[model samples]
Target: MALPTLDDPFYYLANFHTVLDWLGSRYADLLSAEERDFIAAFEALPRASRALLVRMVMRKGVDFRASRLRYAEIGDTRAAAAPLIAAGWVETDAELELAALFTLATKGELAADLAPWLAELGLSRSAGKAAWCAALAAESPAPRALPAWLPSLDDTHYRLTVDALGERFRLMFFGNLRQQWSEFVLADLGIYRFESVSLAASSRAFSRRDELEAYHHLHRCRERFDADEPLADLLAEIPREPFDNPWLERRRGRLLYKFAYRSERQGELRQALALYHDSAAPEARLRRIRVLERLARFDEAWALARCAENAPVSAAETQALGRIVPRLRRKLGLPRGAAAAPAEPERIMLTLPRSGWVEGAVAAHLSRDQAPVIYVENTLINALFGLLCWEAIFAPLPGAFFHPFHSGPADLFDEDFHARRQALFAACLAALERGDYADIVRRRFRDKHGIQSPFVAWGALDERTLALALTCIPARHLRLWFERLLGDIRANRAGMPDLIQFWPDEARYRMIEVKGPGDRLQDNQKRWLAFCAEHAMPVSVCYVSWDEGGDERERQDAQGDEGQPQGAVIEDAGAPPNSAAGGNPA
Candidate 1:
């Protein structure tokens, strides 16, 4: 469908109308009486009134100064606002608190208007807006209309009374409040392009009005929490029982986890422990263990850690537990279990002149005539995986896709994300085993080019890099990486080695992780290194040091670093194919 052009003065109105039409048709069964009446009454209003309301809705605040509500298309703002005022959608007499008044009026305007009151309070004109607001705030002035507060001022304020209703409509359309009315504008402007997914009649965000209400309730709670509301009050309002809807439940769980983390930070260990116990968040168990340990409840922490170790929720949890469990066991006077140390990857030590990006400098140092290095940190492998599993990732299962603007499935990070699309993924991965993976990936790259995706970094994955990766990286290695990604996508999708050196003639590749001085490996990076070692994949860590004394020499080397002397191999600690340099898996 062609989007409405910005040239049309009513483009925003058209976008809003599009949402209403979509909701009225697809979510008729779910609409409340208020919503239905709103749609009917809104359509009955004059085009100018509707356009004026949309303008306010798309803006930052509900309170709009009538003098500033100027639109050539909506001539005579008062005439356009009359119908909205009658419908109670736009309020001319809405009460404004002192803070709100401060927001609407200029400092000079407030100083002039409130001069008498300020004189009575002995506040000087030199006082800034904050000082004036503070002085007025102490008086506990009653909320009144803008005109009433500043009787001498000529301006009038119009508040959009149905701002909350408009937000609800937006939530229904976008499935989340994070995305706003600008999505339509962005889409029309060609700044964003989404895949055209066929949405069925049943394809709507909320299946029931209660679900909508629950989502709204959770949204309100989130807003309050973000506003730094009292944690105890927020907790009391949050429903203890989980929502039946998995999506809503996840939201509630994450919110609970956030509150628990805040409580922990505030030194309320018991409160944090209780909230963590109640939350269904994936990392709640680990947090609970940590909170318990903080409270010096060693036995409980130990027991929970053991249980979590037995059935870890994710690789991250397992990795954390490995450290926590041992400490807890030692604290409990249990004998330390001897564990084999993980094999360390080969290390390269370089003393090069400080250049631009460390990774690019390393790439230059490593690239050969037969072997070219590409800096692809976390992009190449992810892009390939995305291309191979494009269909599986975008499979139009119920609840997976509700809108055409979705870059990927809504449940991409859900626990059952992989399980739900198990068959589809299995089919996609089968191409790897069948030796037809390259063809499928190439086809997807060609067909789905320029389409928004969660994994494909289109700007980074050029045709040359793609061809080189497909040629150098083996199918078995790709399968290993893909399977690991599926195991825990949210955890494993990142932390790939920074640079990849490919030998197309030998059909071989090596991934290199670059580290500048004083930089240590992150936990995720360590995990990737271990995974590579376990599979005997050719991988190495490159440690770089700047030659402070060799500045002139380094400057010369920077011009053509490929001809510069190579870095020394400091350590070859891991198993075979222990090369000091290598390429990425794209």
Candidate 2:
């Protein structure tokens, strides 16, 4: 039975258990050993303060989190949260919702599980979905919690821990990336390439898409991406210029440092000393001191460094090292001067734009009668309008209407194809007539189920329009796009045209391309056009010109010259000064 949920302010205070333990440990030095004392003799904390610490602890602890589907299926909802609401613990935030959902997954019903009942007897009024979705939207991705069942959390377990956090949350959640990232999984998880999605509900930014993009980016490392690892520029998101693939270059220096540092962390002095012997760089040597001082091995770390040919270093640099350095010096030998150091590698994040011109709510036209700038600008415009009109009206409505690339003869009757097509055509015209893309989508489509916003409008369209539109998009613009998507620059690549020269002063690199052509596509071009049609990142196309470029012989000559290069694919540069993609380089 679903109980009426009263808003619970105390619910606003739930947190991970680790946070509380950390805070409690800070006062361990002040507290006297109580092996001989009775618990009754100790003073108790106030309820308010006790609650605060409890909440903090819950937020920080990584143990007890489950990765099973049972946990994910037991999603938090207004009804499921009713128990917390009843207990005055139902404030609306991610911690509270996740906590409540977690309780239901393990303990029992914190609130009525809402999905079944809502599906059976539809919910016309649900502040619950809204509130819970809001909560999920704000959650930063937390460190992966290990199952209590793991023997010991090693690096493999550490990797799985991150995986489990992904499995646990039903709806999207924010990831708090403040903790250091694991190096082993870095390339596979696209940790460096930035991304963001515009949340429909709150104007508030959520880091979920950022994490998802990073994850997808990393997964590309197998097979085709092997050894073609992203450069540090791809990891341009890292502090200091990351050394391309540090694993491939300075792996030993960093790995040894990690081993020595971890040894110090575990208080294994002999092991740490052995690991430091593996270091080759000055940076790695200094890192040994930092770890030792942190572990109160100051005398050894200091002595070890001095007995070598290491060059003299700055006092400021020494003082700026680890906090444990001075503390270790005091404990292991005579203490030296101390200087407060701000947190290094501060919490810096790379946030990609949520929405822009390519994905923006705007309209521009292309031509279909004749392609290549050799044709007049007016010709390009009328042709594009004709191409789309023919595409929208002539193409098979649903099955035949599918984007030619992503799907084949398989799975023809899926409802998504028709629904999306109707929505795309409707949304495009709505924006075209209104001049306000966002307003049109929000007014006509957002609540309607499929098309919602422009972010999804392009891909959500049926296969036919998508495939044809991609084919219609000129080749040159597509080339530049393929380049930007890569983590590394292509070797033996020709210098790309700087179409940055043609874009409007206001639009950096955002306008959608208009591929115009009055003719049918040849075989080689079709292969590429198919890829774009299938992926649908953010683009639309229309045939611009049909009859202005060089002959088939010239095209073949261009492709086959001795120094011309093989496996070459022609693509658009970008929007051009005269026509859309500035008509071929002729």
Candidate 3:
């Protein structure tokens, strides 16, 4: 007994059930009602004829040769594929034709088989490749008119409408379209494995493997792009292959951001803004703001700056904006300071033994049962201030800040950064009266954008803390003093008073900066103290010294030169006997 070849009617008769079952289950949606009815006619065929039809359908082509099927897996004699020939699903060929072989070569079939059997056909490797490509170029399967009963898909929604099986199969079949078949292989769980892997020799599989490796090499090259690289070729190639990964799009955006930044730095402000338009990062917005201002589009810059005023920002961003806003205000002819708001004329400064002693003494002196005190200077103010003005500080303003600094100027002087900073400060000041302070503070703590102060921790910001902090400093005065300190956030961020003592009943709080004898005020600290005094925000400086030699120390104003003291000293404690007279504290 022997099995019939693909050309035999017996082959179709034998395999018909397999093909019909496949179509009914996996590709049932693709068949029209009439086509399905036509296919049903095959059920009436004798079992033998149906089996042959199934095999031919599984092979998925119309041409075959008995000589090619000389061997049989089931111990069947090779006979002509008569049932498929009669059914019109396949046609018999005298032998393998050059066009067919070339097709096989293009599909990675001949490459592996060629070396072992090419001598039988008398062809060279180079010549074989050319012939494969030529056949691929010329070979187009004849299109059959679609059945009338088939459901029509809107061309616009074709991609979206593809069923999962259909889509995966399409990728399997046509994923390597326009490229050599050996260049692409569907290895992902055989969704594209309609053809038998055994058809192409093992060596040809290796060749296809190499081609896929080459394709991924192109992918790696794409990841190396920076602002300085030549990107035209890469940009063009990025969309050529339909890769399914999402990170590729992100890489493209980053490249575009770098390019836009470069263009902006080159003084091509218009081009830079255009390139930056696609980037949604806050930094991109900042860059656009800077460009708009540089181009004298002040209104546009101001509008964007206002948007950034409420957006979450970092400490560095807040400081940058602080520096930028005043300049922008000056450019817009706004006054730098409010109309001479009178502050407290009397000033008090205390000297402590060391840094750790300042907060304890201040807390002891000011802490009432109703009003609790916490030690939070740079980190707390920065966190709270940054939370309120986060939008301005973290707006991703172009060239303001970078990690692992890149070459080129940061272009931080543009008016929009500063202008937005001003808007943010104003917004923070207004938020105090509207009873929305807690929510913003909550969001800031939740987001953890720039929060670093332990005292401003989410749990630490209990009801009492938030209520006091919100009302502690006068809104107008806080705005004025905060504005003055914005000149340099990094330097000024740390110099805020060591303790915040609030009187909840009185709805008042004081910012107290402590200095030890021989210690002096820094430039930023002096600026903050001056602003606080000028705006009537209750602020104090305490100078502390150790009680060595049983000494009694007096408080002094710490505002003169960097290392020198200014203002009169008031004695608070009883003087020690035999104390040296006229000795400078330093």
Candidate 4:
């Protein structure tokens, strides 16, 4: 469908209309009576009225100052709003509480409107708005309309009464509240582009209206939790029973996990344990085990850890269980179980001159004329994999995609993400074994440049880097990394080595994990290192120390280093050997 051009004065209106039509066609069974009536009434309204309502809905707040609602295209705000107000879609008398009043009125207006209240409390007129609001908050005045609060002000407050309804529509369209209406504007302006996926009638975020309501409910709970609401009150409201829908269940589980995590932090172990038990979030089980161990309930933790080990929710959970299970066994005086982790990657010790970023310093120290080192923390491999598996990742599965502007499939991190497209992913991976993987990757990189994917970092994976990676990296290594990624896309997508050095002539590459002073390998990084070691991939951990005497020289070098190639200095103190055969690259 063609988006409305910005040249059109009612572009937003046109976009809103498009959304309404799409929702009506796709979610006809899911819309409530109220939502259906709203759509019909909205479509029947005058163009100006519809535009005015759309403007208010698209804006930041529900309450809008009529005098401030000036648009050249939408002449006479009062006339435009008259029909909306008549239709009960806009309210002239919105009860603004003290905080809402503070938000709506300017500082001068506040001082004038609350002159008597401020004077009664002896608040200085010169005081800041926050100070005035804080002082007036103690008075606890009832909420009042603008006219009631400011008798002399000649302005009507056009509060869009249908904001919640509009948000529901928005939620239906974008599948989440995080994406705003500006997406349409961005798409229209060519600032953002989306792949044209065929959204089948069956492809939608919510299968039923109840699922939509559950999502909305969870969203509000998350908001309340973020707003610092009382945990006990929120816990009481949060549904302990899991939703039949996995998507909604995942969301609920995530929110419960947060609440449990907060409770654990607050030393409420019992509360946290209970919440974690109720949560179906993937991490909740591991957390529950940790909390049990913390509470000295070794038996319970051991039992749960064993169950989780038998049927692991994810690779990450299994990895954590390996650690927790062993410790719990020792605490319980049980026989040692859990297998040994893979050997760590080769270690390289370097004492380089202090420079800007530690990774940059390491890259410069290790890079050679023949072998170029790049600081690709997590981008290179992910980009290569994303390019190779473009088809599998963007496979138009039911519930995977429903909207046009999705950066990636909605179920990218879901448990069944890989299972659903196992065959498609197998076909993609087969190219890696068929000696045609590089060609496929290169083609995808050229064809799908700048189109959003969860894995591809477009800015980082330039042509030069892609070419070097494709030439030097072996297909076997790519397959291993891609397999690990598909194992747990949410967890394994990150924590790659900080830098990669490529030898195009030798068709060899080495991944380097750099550690600065006081920096240590994170858990995810450790997992990645172990994975590389187990797979016999060339990887190393670089321990860097600063040369105290070269501080001044390092500063000087940094300033004049703009045009210099990476690792320009061949003889720096403690620099890695120039030859690839020097063993550890350091």
The candidate scoring highest on lDDT is 1
* lDDT at position 231, candidate 3: 49
Residue 215, candidate 3: Cα error in Å is 32
Ranking by TM-score: 4, 1, 3, 2
Clashes per candidate (backbone, < 3 Å): 6, 63, 53, 0
Computed on alpha carbons, the lDDT of every model, listed in order, comes to: 0.87, 0.31, 0.47, 0.86
lDDT of 4 by residue, 231-290 (tens): 989998888788888889889999999999999999999999999988988889899999
Per-candidate TM-scores read 0.90, 0.18, 0.32, 0.92
CA RMSD (A), model 3: 23.0
Give the per-residue lDDT digits (tens) of candidate 3, residues 1-586: 1222445534434333433453455445545465476467667654544444444333434343333333343233122234434554444322334444343223244455445444445556667567544543354433221111111311110011112222223222322213222212222222121111111111111123333333344434545554345544554444333233223334345556776787777777887787677654346777777788899887777677666666634434443455556666777786784433334322344433333565676555445566566777664565566556655554334333321111111222332445645665566657766767657866765665323321233443545555577666555554564564465443455666777767555556666676666768774566566556665556666555543422232233343353332322333322121122101122
lDDT score of residue 208 within candidate 2: 37
Please list the residue runs of candidate 2 whose C-alpha ends up more than 4 Å from where it truly belongs after superposition: 1-256, 279-283, 287-586
Per-residue CA lDDT of candidate 1, range 1-586, in tens?
3568988989999988888988987899988899999999999999999999999999988998998999999999989999999999988868999999999999888977799899999989988889889999999999999988888789889999898999999899889998888888888887787888778978988899899988999999999999999998888888899899889999999999999999999999998998998899999999999999998999999888889978999888888887888898888999997766886777777776677789998888667777789999999999999999998999999898887689888889998999999999999999998999999999999998888999998999999899999998999899999999999889898999999888887788888999998899998999999899788888889888876766566556556556345432223324333243343321
Off by over 4 Å in 4: 115-126, 335-341, 550-586
RMSD of each: 3.6, 26.8, 23.0, 3.6
Q: 292, model 2: CA deviation in Å?
A: 8.8
What would you estimate as the lDDT of candidate 1? 0.87
Q: Model 4 residue 448 lDDT? A: 88
Give me the candidate number with maximum TM-score.
Answer: 4
Q: Write one digit per residue (lDDT tens) for candidate 2, span 1-586.
A: 0111114333322222222222233323322233112111111333343333233223433222222211222343233333322333223222323443343232112124434433444443344554543444355424323222122322111111222232212111211222222211231233321112212222111223433333333333222223543332333332222233322223334444555565666677666665665654345566666656555566776675554324433222333343334555567657586564322210111111121331121121121223211111122222222223222322344223111111111112222332435554443444334544323323322233231111223223433333332344433333333322121111101122101112222221212232322334332223223333334322223233322233654466456865432222224333343443233211
The alpha-carbon deviation from the true structure for residue 87 of candidate 1, after best TM-score superposition, in angstroms, is: 0.7
